[model samples]
Target chain A: MGFIDARELPDGHTVETDVCIVGAGAAGLALASALSSGTGGARVLLVESGGFEHDDHTQYLHQGQVVGREYPLGISRLRYFGGTTNHWGGNVRPLDAIDMEPRPWVPHSGWPITRAELDPYYERALAFLGLPDDAFELEAWTDGKACRPWELEAELAETEIFPAVAPELRQLGAVRRASIEESANVDVLLHANVLEFETDDPPRAVRAVRVATLQDERFRVQARLFVLATGGIENARLLLLSSSVASAGLGNDHDLVGRYFADHLVIPPVGDLWLSDPELPLDLYLERARANATGRAMGRAIFRLPDGVQREQRLQNCGVQLGPTMPLDVAIRRGKAFRSLDYAWRAVQEGDLPDDFHYHVANVIADVDELVAGGYRLASYRAAYPTWHVDLIAVAEPAPNPESRVRLGDERDPLGQRRIVLDWRLSPSDQDSVRRSTDLLAAAFALAGIGRVRVQMPEGGLDWFRPSPHMHHLGTTRMADDPKSGVVDRNCRVHGIENLWIAGSSVFPTYGHVNPTFTILALAFRLGDHLRGVLA
Target chain B: MTTPFAVRRRDVLRLLAALGGAGFGAGAGVGAGAQAEAASRETLVAARVRLRLVSPESASLLGAAYLRDRPDEDSPAHLAVALGLDAGATDIAAIAARHRDDLRSGRVHRLDGFGFSRTELRLCALLYLTDRA
Candidate 1:
């Protein structure tokens, strides 16, 4: 393996390789690792836009404005060798069988590939992520003790397991960096930003990829195959930016390069659960209780609607997790510091300070006593092992909406490339699904005499609903058998383009409430196999 | 042998007492001082006509609270009909059964953000009236 800095390359230099991967994120690395181990003679080029750590220049390139909804785009993702995996929360779970199937109620739902197609690669992905293949088995973790008091009648809800990777192995980039650097057939290039895809006259195939560095050094990488493993938004932006030959863009014949963007909607502490039996053993679902013998929090158990119930009710998948409720005093103390910090960061992003900024700072200063007390309590054992009540967090799946898209804005970055304009939109049915699923969960708990759930959602429609993102960008370059419906084919190859494929959550046709890292790696491994055969 | 009605009345009373003593009232402590005040005999007798098998004092307090909150369902006749109890029935066992069924079937009314089955609501209403009425 060779580690090269883009600046070290001479200007107008050309490098040739068998396979060129555009992003050295989880997908790129996984694909590279798979290719290096399986494909005997293929030379792999792994290119990254940033160095090993976060840089201000690359972060600025990620800055974009929102059109339809207010979303923090720049701060949500990282730009480095590891990509967003550098700060990923480490929770992992494969998508359910229903998530891959098309629902009659959901317009642009369903994947060209099924769960069975990815099953073999999923095990490899888990092993690559440093977990046992059986990590998602909820019964193994709880031994059935964590189930509801009575069997939920008619299978209204089901429990799903989400295991957190080991703390030391959480940063996949750092964990696999040494091995990737030592692979004999791979070349890792840092600060090698891809400018555009230089294609033939018809734009039926990608000829070469133009790469650049912040220092004005430009080069070209011609490969037999190309993969844009960039994050979801960047993948679409790159495709839409490559307009040198096709005029519209490479593989943008149907104008579907950046449509149907989706991300998970997370609502923290939606309600409180009051258990009828105070001594009920729900430890499997709590953070501290789930900690293994090594004192690392192992995983979490979540509640979601069963497949049959989802189809019958015409609902999207919504996951609800139960954790210990934060004491009100602790919330107030933590909230002051959080509010002040959040406002300051947003002000910096906007390049202007708000009038009430001083008030937030003053409030934080005034609550110093609370801040210290809250910190001490959080570090103490009592805070970790709370048993009084349970707080419910709802993470709802996003239905693909063509109107929710990422497009090029008039504004350009320092490199003269048009910045992204993300217009994220959610349908009314999305909100309705969340409400209905939450009610069903409450009903199950109530009927079992386990407890009661007081849903704290405001009384009204989408106007009163404000959902935060889980930072899992998905469905931007969705996979479908038909070119008109999606950008990528079942094999993740961009439709209507030869030798061009996508590898990441961006190719996900539907994103279940689960995290996308596991499936992203699975797809990467699957693509690696496909590419090996093609290059063979 | 003790009848099922005796066990049910005792249980409801115990639950009501526990809620009041622990201050876990679903807003049941609006007028705490009223419990110190006594209801007139005529008022007690009038309230007692609505239900049987429950103590006169318990019946009076609960009936007044029930009538005050759900003024539309003025008497036990309406409450029995709403709870799926036999019309005009004053059986405590039947009342308890209806309460359990409501909870089991997800039929609950909310008061002060706390969910309560209709039977539990009636009892909570009684607790609130005892402290205030």
Candidate 2:
């Protein structure tokens, strides 16, 4: 078997391989599987800090202080083999072409590699993700019934399709674990925590990696090349921790190691869409079974502004999804009644009334009939269709700000490694993008005579509506053509260092308004093909 | 002499009065408070006439029936008093006019003291527009 318990190995043992991958998460495992299956003659060593299941001791290592917003650090990520994909929702989308182009208004906002360069790899990544190899065409999936004639001009807004494969069948560990076990030239080592890189003089090239096990076992893995497939945060953390050679960091010669952190900002429901044509079949815009496909579900059709509109308005990429809404009174009463009963039951269990017990009871008494009617509507419509209106929930792309970064804190973990301090910052341009995009959409709907849209601003206005993080960590170690602007080059190799590279969303220069897993996998495949060519 | 709008208005007024009386009678004994019941019936009639020009069918489809069947505990008199109107007065037309003005000014007028929600306030605005027409 390719699996090896690193703790069982003899102390001071040295293993030799052609390539040593530091992490066994989604990117790491995908790259390892690709290399092992290739015709190349290179042997691979894949290291994982945690075992097959969740381990609290290893999970606790991810805990750290959050500065700007209240972020749940400990629960946001997993330390196991599959990484965060253990709980991912499996939403995949490719970055738009505009997302890869440099916008003059947005500082440090462009990719060294364009979307066209990644298109072939994205097609290959679909097989890895278990999605259909065909293009994400809405007509093919919906049997031509999905597209409805838009009354508005197509330049204003367009329908975007999102396809979701079964997450369980496509999880990295679940899909490739068997193949990895039977591979002849690949070694899977669990509980092997990569501590630092031991480099030759001048530290321009990586020679060996030092790994430590929880049981105090130490070993060295010498390889021809080393790839840091660790996640966005840890990739920078490992580089920063390996300061014995470069002082600032291995790739920090230009002082740009851990910078340009970004995450998608999901704005709260900003408007309500009351469709004039009540007979319009909205099932296509909702989660439903594909017409001919079995065991696969088609995601809701999202509305995105066309590229021309985005450029004209100078707004960031944002997409809107329709969410069911109801009269505020009905929703409040039903919610209050349900919460009251839940609190009463909890009070019976705890033997004490909650502080807001009377408030809940009074709300239930005030609108009992409306509450009953709301319940009937909810039961009949399944809470997916609103009785009167629907809300416009916008998922927006945040601008790349060099100030929003992840740095090492003074606190140390059980392994004596410094923890991360996340300062997640959003710019004023980010908020402006959301506001302007909603305005343009509302204007388009009005011009088309489809319906009226009422922008629902908070009592304190747009500033009061704080954008919540989408947990998509990206852009920390960005890719740029020059070493002065980024940590990695176009090939994902460390700018000045040889035999060292990066994988995953850490190399994303700009994050589009979609999930990053598919893109991460595609980039890993590209890197794998490149490494195969180099090693051969 | 009644047009279709006026006829529909009358029918809606009768329905609203009936619903209000039935609800009030259920909550409070019908025979014990005949004077208060008569006053609620008059208020419902006045409200129906004031809302005659609005699309009563659309208003009913939007769950106006809930307003009648489950009227808030506070009476129209209490709402008028809270709005700084004279006591014993329930001029829904005047209330609707003020609400329309607040909406035109892009301000959300507080209706919590009058025991009404935004949906209920919208219905009141429809009544006001009908009365003006």
Candidate 3:
């Protein structure tokens, strides 16, 4: 394998390979690694827009407008060799089986493939992610210690385990970069930004991709097969940009290329829980260090609504986790004495205090005893053991809406490419899912005699509940069996293009509550195997 | 002379009533000494009736304290006692009336330097009121 900087290549250079994969993120890197080792022995070319480290010029290319709500477009994604994996939190869990099935309530829901079909690939993906096999099965990973007590039996809620690899070993490029660089069948090209796709007459098959460098160098990459592994937003942007033959875009004959965009809506702590027995071991609910045959792994348990409950209630899939919560008034009053003094001094210097200044002062005075007690507890816990209390936090699936999409904008980047316009919208059903799920969870908790849950609803109802996006971009170029409904086919191939395929979460028809990286790897591995069989 | 056991039980009841009154207002005590005397017999009857409302576990815990046995400090009854209430007071109705004004105003004063959180103190005040109501 040889590493090449496309900027250094001569002008009008052309490279030919058996398979060319665009975007060296988790999906692209995984596919390249898989193809290089298989018995088919096909040559692979992985193209990345940015260098090894982040470059400001390349990152600025992701800047765009957000028509609905304030989405941090420029800062949400990083354009580099490793892609956004460099900064990901490494929370990995497979989507539930029901997420793939069509629901009457969820519009444009259902995956062309079922969970049973993807099970083998998910098992293989565990190895790629460095997680223990069958880690997502709570009983197997926790050695049967993850069970809830009989006294707290609630049919609506069940624990789901998330198995995450250590932070240092999770980066795809950093962990597998050496093997990829050493492989004889792979060639990695940095700074090779694919500008447009050149296709045959009628644009049924992509012939080659025109590449451009920041220094104005031009080249072409001809391949037997092409996979666009760019993220959710960029995948649609690239397809929309290639409009030579199909004016609507290569696979946009039905005008579905950039439609049906979705992302996981993460709602912060909406309720508080006070357990009757504070001494119960909640280690499963909290992040714990576990020793397995391989090495140390991190595990955290979350409560998911049972499939039966979701079907009966007609609600979207959601998961709830326990997190520590303190009343805002108490937290402010319980600061260190010196910090309180400093705050009081600052307020005095400002000439006038804000509203409820006297009330806050009274609270601080009232909390002096608690402050001293908390100091002792902190010192004692540091010397010996510790305790934890938590509130309920939830993540819910967003119903797919064609109105939420990404389109090519008028403004062009430094490379003369039009930037993207992200119009992220949430449908009424999406808001209903969060509200209904939270209410059910609260009822279940009260029924179990665990405690009461105080749901925090916005003053203006569910419509006013503004949740910050979790950056898990999904479903721009969604996959389906029919061309009129989706951009990609069942095998992730662009509906009309023969040799071109789409990878990553962009092909996901529904955005499950779980994080997308693990599933992305599974799909990539499955695609890699498919390509190997085809090329052989 | 009353035995120490009987005296201790009476003392605990008086303290509970005084703590409850303190949460209402101290002004409720002024010029109410005659009224408290009038209500003393009724207050005792009220305390007996309210004792039925407390959970059996809480009642047992309070009984253990009255018997001079070391009850669990985390027990609800002991928690109420630890939150600035004198456990050795006499005359339940008089002390309750004396602290009514401050109690009604929700004024909390740190009589003892014991480290109790506001939540715990509030819970203690609530327990006392529930018992005396």
Each candidate's B-chain TM-score, in sequence, is 0.39, 0.25, 0.26
- State the lDDT of candidate 1 residue by residue for A1-536, as single tens digits: 47789899999999999899999888998999999866777899998999988999987889898998788898888889888888888888889999999988988899988999999999998788767656777655765564422344447677777788876677777887898778889998899999899888888889899998998899999999999998999999999999988777778888888888889999876676765445567766764224344334467677887898788878899899985555654475357775686667667766889898888778778876776776676657344333345778999997898889999999998888999999999888888888767766776665555566767775568996788888889988999999998889999999888999999999988898999998999999999999989998
User: How high is each candidate's TM-score?
Assistant: 0.80, 0.73, 0.73
Error of 3 at A235 (Å): 0.4
Q: Model 3: residues >4 Å from true position, as ranges?
A: A140-154, A325-389, A458-460, B1-133
DockQ by candidate, in order: 0.13, 0.03, 0.02
Query: Model 2 chain B, poorest ten-residue lDDT window?
Result: B21-30
lDDT for each residue of candidate 2 in B38-96, tens digit (9 for 90 to 100)? 34533232222122123343333222333344356124333234333424233455544
lDDT of 3 by residue, A1-536 (tens): 46789999898999999899999998998888778887366789998998888999888878888897668777768788878898887888888999999988888999999988888888888887777876776766454443333134446577788877777667777887888878999989999889988898799999999999988899999999999998989999999989887788879998887788788887777555534333445767777656666665788888877888898888999888887434432353457543565466657876868675675577558777766676666566433311122567888899999999899889999889999888998888777788667666654553443443445554345567787788988999999999988898888999889999998999999978999998998899989888888787
lDDT of 2 by residue, A1-536 (tens): 48888989899999888999988888898788779867366899898888888999888878888996666667767887888887777778898999989988777889988899999889888777766654377665454443443455587777777777674554577667888888888888888888888887688999888888877799998999999988888888888888887788789888777787888888767677644444445665665534223235445677888888888778889988777555553464447666675556656766878687777678668767766776786666633332234678888999998898888899988888888899888877888788767766764553353444556653444457587778888888899999999999999999888899999888888887988888998898999999998897
Model 2 spans with C-alpha error above 4 angstroms? A143-152, A291-297, A325-374, A377-387, A458-462, B1-133
RMSD of 3: 14.7
Q: What value of lDDT does candidate 1 attain over all alpha carbons?
A: 0.75
Which regions of candidate 1 fall more than 4 Å away from where they truly are?
A143-154, A288-297, A328-387, B1-71, B87-108, B115-133
Clashing pairs in 1: none
Q: Which 10 successive residues of model 1 chain B have the least lDDT summed?
A: B21-30
Q: Which is the better candidate, 1 or 3, if ranked by lDDT?
A: 1
- CA shift at B69, candidate 1, in angstroms? 6.9
Q: B27-104 in candidate 3: lDDT tens per residue? A: 222223323432343332222222212232232223332223222353444444443343433555544433432322
lDDT of each: 0.75, 0.69, 0.70
* Isolated chain A TM-score, each model: 0.88, 0.87, 0.88
